[model samples]
Target: MSPIEAPTIEPVSPERLAEASVWIAKLHGDARGRAIEEGLRRWLQAHPENARAFELATEVWDDSEQLRSVVPFRPLRHVEHRPRWGAMATALACMLALVIVGVFWLQNVGVVATAVGEQRQLVLEDGTRVFLNTDTRIVVKYDKEARRVELRRGEALFNVAKRHDWPFIVTAGDRQVKALGTSFVVRKDVERLAVTLVEGSVLVSPVLPTLPEQIQPTIDAPGSIEQTPVTTALEARKGAGEFKLAAGQRLTFDAGAVTKLDTPSIEKTTAWRRGQVILDDTPLQAAVIEMNRYNEAKLIVADPDAAALPINGLFQAGDSAHFANAVAQAYGLVVIERGNEIVLSGKPIQ
Candidate 1:
């Protein structure tokens, strides 16, 4: 009988090994979720070398005392309970800045915030540059082992610095993004989280908590309907597992746990970075929602007919009056100013 040949093990490249290292760290971090599990499964199955690389990385990560001792940052349990701002009228811009800086200094963490109609830029201690959009907030925590940021609310763009041993992670709600060094935009809205990769790859995974499966009514034997196990919006998202976004790709995770992946228009995605709101056949109502994020005056669409009208153009951010007037003129609607609110309705009968 021929002697059994030794198994051929494909060699893992340095890039694959680095990716494995990041994955190992994330697996041990607070960002572990069903999505991460599935992502790891896929990555391991993609190639034989991937499994070897992951095993090798795991061995190193386990043996390194520094890696094991790195404590993950826990989000603040206390949320600031304050009256919601109808506009940017809560406080003066300068006053808000002072208050934010005080909080940062006292907490020993970098807290960057932007009120309505305001934007700011900052360079973190790790050389990461962040561009905060209007009405945004982010808390940065950097330790000897890792760099992390908690996006409490709003949107921001991150230009992460390269640190192979120290991974950069951003956590928003129940989802998180992991990167070594890359440029990406992260937006946390009321019920959604969106991430757009600009120049490098990033891992987008949900945090803990596997959303429960939903139940649906299905017809049984006769005419009676019975409850059946069904996948929810979030379950579908969980099924997609963790997302590995490429440059120019976008991912949106809704509060309901639904996920959408697309290669959007980079120009449109980064328009806000240039202080412009670019709309491409957007509905009047949706346009108002986007415009309101950066303006002091609230825009309300009072008429359903007018709200359904399509708007297409590039407009300045925070210029609610200009956006309202342009939409009204194009759709022949009426724009009425009521104190700080701009109401758009159907034109009155002549």
Candidate 2:
């Protein structure tokens, strides 16, 4: 009967949120429909909080999902051999961006991944398969009209199942990668987002701030981003996000640029999943991080100059002590572990 602690509320799980989305969408934009919701309804009501909560939700949806790429539900549309299709619309209202992404929402959706130093694989109800790299999580939130996932951290290899109605969308940090029909790899670190298209197309866009007043009355549907399109998706994705990738394309995005490299070989880039960090002239700092992932013994490079020095070779991870010794030997340096840090210097400490 009293006001609830609204702001202090922990965020709802995507699946639960998706269920609420279905309730709001089915309400058909009316007060009576809301009155009939779980709260206003009779003893048939399943959850007592559904009424007031659904009310606040309707406002959120109108302010968020009413004008954008809202679609009704279909499953696994992104990985189907064929293309996925959707009906999207935009409308300008007052000083707000009335963005609505209609979906055939599912009741439960979440993305999950393993903890640090752990790798995992998951299959969604739509049949899409996702391989989460070490310390990664994928969320799946579905509705009667749509399915989506939020990649929370680390990396993932996606083998999307086919669905024409419910396309699979992965929101990773500030970037949104849409898998319309594809198998691809996406890695997200605090500083960067890199994507490689293995077998299909994906639209990788940066998140942009919404300028409510900038909404035009025209049906300004942005272009469809695909994997093979050679346009400057990077520029198109600017402000909000950057770039896209088609099958076989490899793109690495930093804060400034999206570099489209040569076609990719999955086996080469993801060889770490097989237990080794494969480097082709990679930086020393990066190699050290890889070793740290699996090693308890610290590797501290006392000489900043030595760390920047370029080196290339395939070394077994278990032999980091040997590796450090080799690096020191090659650079005419010394390796020593004092306390928690291992120092590699140009002079022998022993």
Q: Rate the local accuracy (lDDT) of all candidates.
A: 0.68, 0.55
TM-score of each model, in listed order:
0.61, 0.56
Listed per candidate, the RMSD to the true structure in angstroms reads: 21.0, 19.1
Worst 10-residue lDDT window for candidate 1 reads: 67-76
Task: Estimate, for each residue in 18-116, the C-alpha lDDT of model 1 and write its tens digit.
Answer: 677667655665556899889999999998788876765554443232211111111112233543332222122223323222211111156778899
Candidate 2 weakest ten by summed lDDT: 87-96
Who wins the TM-score comparison? Answer: 1
* Residue ranges of candidate 1 with Cα displaced over 4 Å: 1-108, 209-240, 347-350
Put down candidate 2 lDDT per residue, 1-350, tens digits, no spaces. 23322122233234443455555444443332445565435522655555434443455445333222211112112232422212111112211122112111222555465655555545455656676666677677765555578887788887887776667777877777777667888888777777888886777765555434333112112443333332243335443333555567777767666544557667666654454455555566676776565455667767666666555555544346755765676557787877756667774322
Task: Candidate 2: count the clashes.
Answer: 51
